[model samples]
Target: MLLIVGAGFAGLSAALRARHLGVAVTVVAGRERAFDAPECLSLEGVRALHDCGLDARQLQLPPVREYISRWGESPMLSRAPPPGIPKNIMLGRVQLLRALRACATEEGVTFVEADELYRVLPTRQGLQLQFTGPVQELVLDASFAIDASGRAAVLARKLGVGRRTFDHLVAYGVRGPVHGLPEGVVHTFSVADGWVFAVSDSPGQAHVCFYTNGRLAGRVTEAKIMERVPYQIRSLMSDEDMWLASGVSAANASTSLLDVPGGTYWLACGDALQTVDPLSSSGITTALQQGAAAVSAAVASLSGNLEPMRAYWLESRAHFDSYVRNRNSFYGFGESAS
Candidate 1:
């Protein structure tokens, strides 16, 4: 049996794929709601979802065909979708998680919802997990474990694997009713201090965020962000529309893979392994891909062939390195232009 931690896209994908491989899989996730913000589903992400048996069209997500950007007082620049590129969709993050979880359930994947992971002990036969929640205590033993607990890297950190953060960027945002915005286009404005992005996920509801260095982010208020945005966006903010702001690292970070794919017993995927800047717009796609790859690695390792796990580690490392390089280039361009 395989134990997957966290029930987000990564963990659910891993659970579903492992079940398809005829393996017994159980997913343990915290009780926290997944609806933190809005997310954009790129063409690649949409394909991944479809491969996982999700129909994006059936979800009724808004399709984005273009993007409008304004950089530091420059005139608005309109970008058309590139040929052969599939339409990208924007939807509420929580809604997608719920859909994925429902699909996993339909696939016969067991889900254990807990408030916290109390302990993980590796024993002679396999690994044992102890979880605490509102109802009662539960323990699970499995031959292998997949750490899809995201940036927390629960198992990785406990195993003494280290992580590296490449930048000190932070993003703060709010979600509320926003008017006077195009339905299917993302609007971005580059300010002197940082950048702001706004997109309407539904008819009237939207998500807006400001990405800035940590120091400035600490002092960035909603009013300040409103001032930085274009007049059209600023004018649409209604006093009755609620706003809330929270900050998280927008930097590139990755865990050192020294002990990952270790001895065919444990591995990490998704944000647990590496995280890219939001500008790359690859988080969900990368997470789903890694989740599927983790299942393949787990299946191969259980069969006494460790080659696939090793290869997966190398591939994950290479992907992170390439992502970092591209992220740096993109940020550098914005800085130079400013």
Candidate 2:
């Protein structure tokens, strides 16, 4: 049996693939914390979803048309399709999770909703996990474990995996009704020491956020950040007629990677393995694909072939290195924000 943790896109994709391969898989989900922001996916990412047996078309909504960014003194840059998005393709959290869970359930994947994981005991047969939900405590066994626990890397950390974080990037912002903006435009603006992003996830419901150093997050307020927003974005809420949800929130948007993707009978995928800047637009894209990657390595490891696990580590390292280079290159137009 295979045991998986977390229920985000990464976890669900892993479960969907594993069961399709006729593996007995059980998923332990502590919680699903959806980020209140817009998630972008490239064409390749859409293909990955279809590979995972999900109806990718259901999520294609709100329709993003172009990407606009104003950084340093460079002329405002605009990109279409590839960066703009090909068609009706904006991935929302609700639609994604609902579709993934439905697919997993129909395929005979067991789901255990738990409050927290208490113990991971190893036996000759497999790894035994003990967790508690609201009503009762439960235990399950599996030959291998796959961690999709997001940035926490819960299972990976417990198994002695170390993480190398590249920066102290954090994002603080709010989401609500934003009006009088070019419909379906994703905007990014470089401010005093950070950047601001604004986009309509659905109709008039806009998701906006400010990204900067963790230290500056606490010192800045929504009004102050809004003040730094470029005229184009500020125009969205600049009018007295415009209103929005108050109280900005914070979440880690740092770039980090795991020292080892996996060892022995366990491995990690998605945010648990590595994280990149949200602006890179690859986090969710890579996450949607990590499920299959994790399954391939885990299945090989379960069969006593450690080569796949080693290869997985090497691939993860290479991917992270390449991502950093690409991210840095993309930011070349802008001065350091933090």
Candidate 3:
């Protein structure tokens, strides 16, 4: 039996693949909703979608481009926005979860809701999982445990896996309606505190986020952040327009910078292995791709051939490193936001 934690894109993908391989897979997801990606484009913009193999024809929205900012020392305008994306191409967190649930159920994967895993013990006969929920605490036995628990890295942290944090910058986001904006024109601007993003969800809905230092964090009032958008549009939004995961949500109506740690799992596929910046909009693309990657590794590991798993981990690490480098370079104004 295989036990997987979390049910985001990566977790769901892993469960689906494992079940297809005839393995008994069970998933434990904390919440049913996956946060929707902002309609906004990243500095590298949307063209990266093509690189990730997202089918453009399936989305019929027109492309929007504009002059954004340069990050590095050069004082010049950065031209050429990411390729414009069709509104239909983007899937909200709720829709993604529903789709994954359907796929996992059809594939015969066992899924449990609101169950939190507290412990994992790898024994001679397989692995044992201790979980707690509304019902009661239960123990599950499996041959292997895949920690798709994401940034929590519950299993990995317990096993002494270290983490690396990037520079001082935090991010907060709110999604709602906005008008009179180009579909593909995602704007990244610098303020006295840090950077702010204006992302479009559709013709009317938009996602606005601000990144500020810890000291300046307290001032990002919900009202001010909303005001960052057009006045007429701001009036149409409410506080609940934002979706914040625990620990990352703002309470004083301010934005916070979080530690950007490039994490890997002791064992597993998907986000448990690595996570990219939402700024790159590669979350879903990579989650789907990594799900396949994890399945390949898990099969190899099970067959006593660990080489494939190791290779997969190496490739994941290399790709994320490139991503970090690309982001730093873009912020420094060296490369086009590719």
Q: Whose lDDT is greatest here? A: 2
Residue pairs clashing in model 3 are 40-199, 44-337, 46-82, 72-332, 72-333, 170-257, 177-205, 178-204, 220-253, 221-253
Candidate 2 residue-wise lDDT, 203-234, digit = tens: 67677777876666557665665565556455
lDDT scores for all predictions? 0.72, 0.74, 0.56
Whichever of 2 and 3 has more lDDT, that candidate is: 2
Clashes of 1: 0
Worst 10 residues of 3 by lDDT: 251-260
What stretches of model 1 exceed 4 Å from their correct place?
73-87, 219-264, 333-338
lDDT by residue for model 1 over 133-224, one digit each (tens)?
A: 76998898989999998877777777778776655556766667777775776877666666677787667766777676665545765556
**Residue pairs in clash, model 1:** none
Lowest lDDT block of 10, candidate 2: 73-82
By the lDDT metric, which is better: model 1 or model 3? 1
Model 3: runs farther than 4 Å from truth?
Answer: 36-88, 182-192, 213-215, 218-266, 333-338
Residue pairs in collision within model 2: none
